[model samples]
Target chain A: MTRPDRAAIIGIGYSDISRNSGTGPGTLIARAARAAILDSGVAKEDIDGVVGVYGSDSPTVWPGYVVDSLGLPNVTWWDTAQPPSIVGLSSAAQAVLAGNCEYAVFYHGKYRWGSTSIASKGDPLRESPAHEMDPTFSNPLVSHAGSLNWAARVMRHHMDRHGSTREDFGKIAINNRTHALTNPRALFRTPIKMGDYLAAPMIDEPMSLLDMDAPVDGAMAVVVTSLERALDGPHTPVVIEAFGSGLPIGSEGNLWPEADGLAARRAVASLFGRTDYSPTDMDLAYPYDGFTILTMLWLEALFTEEGGGPELLRDAWSEDEQVLKLFGRMPMCTSGGNLSEGRATQGFGSVLEAVQQLRGTAGDRQIGGSLNTAVITNGMAATNRSTILSVS
Target chain B: MAHTRRNYDTQPYWEGCDQRELRIARCADCHTWIHFPRGVCPNCWSDDVRHEAVAGDGQVVTFSRPRVPDGAPPMVTALVALDAADGVRVLGRLEGAEPDAIRVGMPVSLDWHEEDGQLVPQFVPSGGAPA
Candidate 1:
């Protein structure tokens, strides 16, 4: 029961990776699920589980719709997850390990955000219900719509405490963009300098347009099965060594802990506590990059060191070999992340990237040399979920 | 635009807002304050809670100014922590103050605005309390 290694991600696949998918969300989810099943070399009859964080843009892409559209026969385990999800995959993994289902398909799909209005239910407009009501018993004010303002406030708070600068955030943007150039599926392949990030127009004070996720229309899927089942698959199985689903601490007072550090720290503790693997054992860290600030937070949260999340990120991307040595050879966000790779895939895309890395199939953007362990995360705030994946 | 949808638990708060008064639920036994209008007390598992008016004064916990392209003009909002209420926070627009001037811990008082025939509460600098 202790060895969760019984579960592994055997297949990774996706629909079109573009701004405009030109198809219904159900179609996208089905196509990606089909590709994943095909890639796993598993017959559709062997599949009995389906879990996905479908439709950040539309609710029509629910489990029932997907089950019906994909013609999945007798799904024993099926459920829908909240949008921008990373924890949904854990549910699938748990189902596999528990023997509730033999093969589980975790997938998500969404349409391009063309002139889509920002202020909506799950956005910043609703601040974790607990923090939204006034004790004075007055009518509550509608909160702001986007993450930019929240991110800016967190940045300002981080700056106030640690003396981190806009340049630090710019460095993260530049690093993700740098990796994007090598990822053909990335929405933005053009290389950008730190100067470009600093010069970008301010969407919110201290947060420029460059610091945000480029919304797009796309879908991604991954197949999770028992190691016994995965061993028979077409590619190397990425073992789910350990995982931590920490609660997100939205905002502490006015200042945010750097990278939602509290949640990241908790997730780190849970991860390292369960397994012998340390951050040093990791070949890469696929911290969620819905925004540049998150990447900084993830690095700080997962690294064994106390402070210097920002400093480490800056050095990791720095061309100076002496400064880069501080990171000890852990590369990050190999898929260009959501910032450059398009936000529609949610966090499932990162899992797909981790599979590609472990199998040594990541063409140009590959990290090269020995690839073993990867640390993948959903956005740390609201939900802090991280998983350690390694070649089995 | 502001809108109010009254449910079984939230009716009292909305009713208080309709009367231009600020009210919150307090547990009679433990004297604990509950936020967002819940039926039972979160403290001591007591249902002995009643809605009562309180001073609308509070301090800003955090504020953000988002770029709303089409609807509102230069919106600045905040999560405010009540002065005397424990663990009670409210979200409101920070009106009558420059977006750049808003900071955490700045004193604020409740105010009101109307949208779609619904009264929505807002926050302003304590110095500019609404009459």
Candidate 2:
């Protein structure tokens, strides 16, 4: 099949990524939406669509609230999506392509609260209801205890199956931290060695604190419009060449599937089938780094042979530069990713960084040559979304 | 707090736990085993799903020892792939083994413990408990 009508990401915006933003979710998202509209050079009255995603634990900030707060008088289409903001991006893009709306603002806001955020634990207002359990926690008997438990299990499984080591996982953390040193928005910028990662406190066996994404209070938004309309805007447009979303065939009730990387491989197949560009054609990649193991899995799914992901990751690390450059040229997650950029849930940070790289506005973290193609993969095994963007 | 609300679909599995039996949902039509019992068979869309006891003989697919707050001992949790129940995998606490002794693909057998006045299924090393 030929490529579908392209949707372009013309503008990107962000609020402060901090442990404590001292504000509500609505305010954070509104700030991001307003900045995105202004950055796109699209008049507020011309924005006819709004799309957003928020964690269930986060305070409710619906799309209608964003439209109201931004005072966008012409919101003909609006919707909210589940976690992993890539779904929201897909929704907004489809809406714009279908002529339901012209310029749509897709926003994602992450609030620090409850068990995830140490800073918000003490605040009474941030406390989620005592009985409000995440759906994963609903069935304690079957569900993996939490994200950490499932992720650690996956890590151990990878190690056992492929003979990969903790050092492999450490390379990903170190590579992300190295890139974060240049990112002003990253939560952790200090350069770390393999020893630092090994010496860190173990939250789960075989996985240290650094292996997990730092939870923070922040928001990010992007403006999506047709490729034709986006070319007339102020900034260079990052065309959405192809988008694919899918789950593993038999993944019913299974979070950590025995066949690891099944979902990612499925997503990659679906994405490549829709676009003319293969994995090698992409100059940059932003694989989700919610957990270090996930990045390893995604890299394997996208580029390397099965069980060869860690080797690729190990080879990608530049010992001299202290960053990951795929094939000694292309960089991954120059924005520090969720690992250091603070987890802006739904892979919003990855998408934002990809857009900035394509626009040639990444500032100090920008790579050497002209970047024309990027592949971004988000979410976990249960639901995965992959998008290919290029500057055409 | 434990989930006090009664769920009709999974009530039989809980009842089996009370009797120290590991029960899983098996579709009467497709014979597919469903964990965390559901109302319909995902494989065949049959409503004739019923709870049945399994041999509960399995091996560890993977395991993790997570540090609990309050300075308690680290908890060993694992996903056990059942030998009899083709595609079903169950998550539960793995008892009677030090964190270092646990390994992927270790043989384990079904066990039980009492939590919140409810009998919960756990796993212990096969043939015997760890010394």
Best by lDDT: 2
Worst 10 residues of 2 chain B by lDDT: B1-10
Residue-wise C-alpha lDDT for candidate 2, range A1-392, written one tens digit per residue? 43248899998997677776654455566677777877999987688677787456554454544543444554545566777779889999987785555689999877665566676566643444232233211244553332335778888888899988888888888888888898888889889998998898988787789889977999988889998899899999989887654343333223354434776776677677677888878899888888888888889988988789888977888888777888877788878789898876557787888888889998998777878999999866544567898997
Specify the poorest-scoring 10-residue window by lDDT in model 2 chain A.
A129-138
- The true-versus-predicted C-alpha distance at residue A389 of model 1, in Å, is 0.6
Give each model's clash number.
Answer: 2, 2
lDDT string, candidate 1, A59-129, tens digits: 23434334434445445455556666567788789877754466888887654333243432333222212
Provide the DockQ value for model 2.
0.18
Candidate 1 docking class: incorrect
Kindly list the per-residue Cα lDDT of model 2 for residues B38-120, writing each as its tens digit. Answer: 55454554557788899888999888777778777668888888998987777888888777888888999988877767777
